[model samples]
Target: MELGSDLNAGEITIAQYLKDVGYQTGMSGKWHIGKEPKAAGFDFSVFFKSNGTYYGRQINDEGIVRKVEEHCDLYCAERSVDFIKEAVKKEAPFFLFHNTQLPHMNGDLIWDARKETKERYEVSEMPVAANRLDDLSGKPEYLKSVRNLSQAKVYGYPDEQAIQKHTRDYYAVITEMDEYLGLLFQTIEDLGLKENTYVFFMSDNGWMLGEHGFTSKVLPYRPSTRVPLFVIGPNLKPLDLDQMVVNIDIAPTILEMAGVLLPDNLHGKSLLPLLKQETVNWRSSFVYEGLGTYGGALPNLTVINKDFRYIETFENGTLEKVIFQEFYDQNNDALEVNNLMGSAAVKSKVGEAQKLINAHKNRILKQ
Candidate 1:
């Protein structure tokens, strides 16, 4: 799991599993694991390295590396549409892993949003986060170091004007990405595949647009940890479910949908039952672990449930020394502005959160 390292040979990726089950697999956009998508079981791919440039980035089309003139998100979408058309021509089931880099910061700010899209939003109209100027007094001390090292520092601590501009550009890039997604969705409907194809809309992580005076995703705050996850497919109810889920669930869900057996080693449960509106027991709590990828933030394990979130910060990557702890009542403080770890109200629940964290660690150790 080192940076730029190849995916382990034994890892059974979703693409590999789908291809094994006779489905055509294609990938477009970021493939930073190492080597290329082909080694990871993608039959066809147009990919680039980590956080590719929005314009004129080098792309590897099936093995031919070349610079593309158009925006990377748009290019990736078009290539994915091409893959879908090819698969339809062959009358084959296909899985296209299309990744987009839109809305992600390019350097200290968002800079590559299309001109027309960028103009749609006025900076003066953008709303800044309430905690944009937080001094980090109530939170973990490491967050102060993170704020100093993060993009907010590069942007000169982000005054009101700077924050508004960043937010405006963020919205613009997202709108651009939405238009690109429309192209894919329209293609699917036009090809008569709308009834069968499953389109999952999700993000790898959420960004901090001046949230708690931070500008990146390394912190374990709600703004950084929470992300959108929705599935579109045939016969699935449109209603929302309140149960919590994690990214690991994606693999098993897709496997079940394809009628492929779920591997016993997979830790996440399939969400197909929930999607079908079936009554079933679901997870009440989920754990979030951050390994301090940015070096300024401390490693931490957080237990998040409907009632509260408990975070235990460690001293280093070893995760041995518990240096700090935080507890927040989710129902009362949805924004997680208040830390209640030292309060008597959460003393009893602290043990419960620790037990959950221990259970997760034991499960990982067994795996």
Candidate 2:
């Protein structure tokens, strides 16, 4: 589906399910999925369309469009806190989708981070990505062409200075976002809701910060696909997990936590067992697909595990006509600088990966 387009009416959202089960739902910031948050089951909404400007912009306050002069993140945080406060006063279980637009580029190579936050970092001290300088000659032809022609090449192929500036602004905006989030966290704590509330932090997608000479996502590489997932709540121990998990798992997990029955149509398993640190059978590998959102990126399907990532690029978004393949031994080549597709040792593994991919396709079709 396109950005700003309505989601399929036949599909049910987690918000709709929760609202049916007696939860007050509110959303703030970045509601790009067409119509308004109310249509998606949010009872209270203060949202903006698409990627909003960091400065003055229009916000939809429960169907009223008004100009917000403050940074969008701050406005979102304040509104989220207010939602929580109101929900608490009503003695209702609440779900606040407090989204933000921080760190995402406002325009081509333009970052609108707060001046104080941006000044905290010195450009000279910013560490460049290890693969930023790669020429992409050994990689896919599509990536090479993208590096040469995309808007990322406007200031030339991301020299140390350019990469440093990007990193600095990126880090600064994230820090500013964290500062704003602290207010909501403090409000929750002050209201004695920290023990009862689950705070899940995650990103929709990871960005390519000069990795493989690319600046955007939509590639089937670690830098473009991998993102952080953090879950904080009552009785959850602090520990790291190596098991593979997908974004789909989040919905089932939340439903399980809220004592709702898992829908048969749900494609993901509940992560409650994993969160409790119980030994459980988990996925060893999962399929990752990219539909070429950025310029020159081919539609690709990939199987990624802790040990390796195998990608098959297609001729177009229809995903027909396999044009190129890439295999990376992630154990040793974390940066994916070397392609292992031609190696004799990985020949058998390639067949195994294809089998896994086909199995995933069948499962998706069944769903």
Candidate 3:
């Protein structure tokens, strides 16, 4: 889908809003939001719009385009530590957003990791996803398109052979990233910021290692959308909540932690209550939107709740026709091999999913 122009100060970012409340803000990581981090009111920032290289990445600091030869994860960790040491000297509250660009596709369309890390996960040791050998007969036509299968074809990712070759590399990248994070964690403990900082960990999206015989994201499948979420803070016990959470909730959760007022127009609510182990009413499902054109899957909407996965494919937004519908009983079909849409007993369940889609459309009209 098309996005608006670059973000400006007219609309305050989370970093900018935090700065207004006397908190020094800084960020170091990948930012593809169509605006410079400095323009968003970050006190100090360092990033290079790299073309998928792990070393010799270019950086346009101010107006100077310079290059650095550090591994991306190491480079980011160094910068984050630098900012933390500086913030400690200032003797005030600070917000640091340390993002990493790892376990993501590189020039070869596969995740890149250190050679040693990759060697640790032998191809024979890799575990293929449950739906690695899925046949797309029950899925929409768009999912079976050659264009959408580009990544999968690059490494035989449509089956277990693909998982053996690619998933190991992906895990290696993540494990290397985890090592660098240990450095950041040490910095936090060394600087005594552990108690005050509430670290939130999440991914932009999940990946599919041959899930449903497909690779890459933008599908209505569980492996394509179920990202990991982790929260760590002082005095906070680990409790996994069953509520549906999305990336949009990150801002509201952070704002609530920083005591900032939430903007009413936000699409997600703060997860702070749930994080605190509070018994509160929460959403049962979330809408997974997939908007695409050439080289991507067809436009679609999916609602994944506690017990079901419902998908509706569209004709690329022209509203010419709905290709079809799919429903999977999560409780009985964790692998999503069974399409429950045609079941006679679950007519009401199908209707409920349709209602969610209709409600979202009505909300858009009101906006």
Candidate 4:
């Protein structure tokens, strides 16, 4: 149940809570929360690394390894389907984390369900959070200061034809995921379990095929930080939450959804009240820190407050360099082009944000 990255990226830790709740918890595909699956506390697990083909492979569950003959998509989906069948047969509330490797990258597998045409894939439109060119339209000076401006240069777009081809493969994976999701949803509906089952669909983080002259998700840009979130259930209303919600909020949301009491030690906020349309005050700022050993030695610390984002990059003992410090009036420049951090008018605001980030770190330490 432990995904490699954040809880939102994959259903890693959420799966752990499911097992803790006495549900028949099972996970298949990329349990990357830690080097060992047992560390995350899962009854059944399938772990994979970050490289190579993400499909037609094997997953290690407990101490035993299980071979999957099908592509990665089918491999995970089928296992989840079987879990659901078993759960229904046993009248047990099952928790199945069917994490997939599709629509992520290194496209070798071709999935018809995920893509239809070259154009759909060429633009990388299949991703819910594709990089928008409009975001970089302004701030010519900032763009110039940053290295690697071309899409082809940044995200390895390859040739025009190659990008189109890659896009096709990417879309195929997305479509395949969408189809499997529909199938899973249908199963619950057909079994008359719609009222009880809650389905949450989201990407771990935004994947960048091109936009912003960037490729992967290590950056603090919206294309990487923003994730698509949707919860569908019988009584849930369709709502778009503009309020800032970080990946940390997910753990508590799932815990609350399962009708479990919030563990006081957890660092996430439950979205149960939000789901019920209760006007509860939520976290206004999202603190982002890409610290730890992953994503190379390029470390970054960013804080996104009401209308400003302060990004500090460091290497070894070098002083912190303000790679990107901007304040965008969400009501106006939502794309975040204005670098108000450099302006004298916003010095006080910038100082306040720094204090907030410092306080946040202190709170985490005290916890």
- How close is each model in CA RMSD to the real structure? 1.8, 1.8, 2.1, 5.2
lDDT (Cα) of model 1:
0.84
Question: TM-score ranking from best to worst?
Answer: 2, 1, 3, 4
Residues 247-307 of candidate 2 have per-residue lDDT tens digits of 9999999999999899998889998999999989999998996764557667778999998
Task: Summarize candidate 4's per-residue lDDT along 1-367 as a digit string, tens digits.
Answer: 2235444343446657777777777666655554565555555555555533555566665566766556666666666666688788889887766667766654432333422543444453334213334355434343433443453354344334444544566666677667766767778878888888887777777755555444556566555677888878868988887777777787788778787777776778887888889999987887786554233324456677566666555553332444444554544545555556567877887787778766766665563
Which parts of model 1 are misplaced by more than 4 Å? 107-109, 147-150, 156-158, 363-367
TM-score of each: 0.95, 0.95, 0.93, 0.78
> lDDT rank, highest first?
2, 1, 3, 4
Error of 3 at 67 (Å): 1.1
Per-residue CA lDDT of candidate 1, range 43-143, in tens? 99998877746888888887898999988888889999999999999999999999887767554345678788889999899988887777766687767
Which candidate do you rate higher for lDDT, 1 or 4?
A: 1
What C-alpha lDDT values do all the predictions have? 0.84, 0.84, 0.78, 0.61
In angstroms, how far off is 213's CA in candidate 1?
A: 1.1
Q: In candidate 1, residue 284 scores what lDDT?
A: 93
- Give stretches of model 2 more than 4 Å off: 147-149, 362-367
- If both were scored by lDDT, which would come out higher, candidate 1 or candidate 3? 1
Q: By TM-score, how accurate is candidate 1?
A: 0.95
Q: Model 4: runs farther than 4 Å from truth?
A: 1-20, 35-39, 61-67, 107-169, 292-297, 317-332, 363-367
Angstrom error at residue 131, model 2: 1.8
lDDT of 3: 0.78
**Model 1 residue 153 distance off true place after TM-score fit, in angstroms:** 3.9
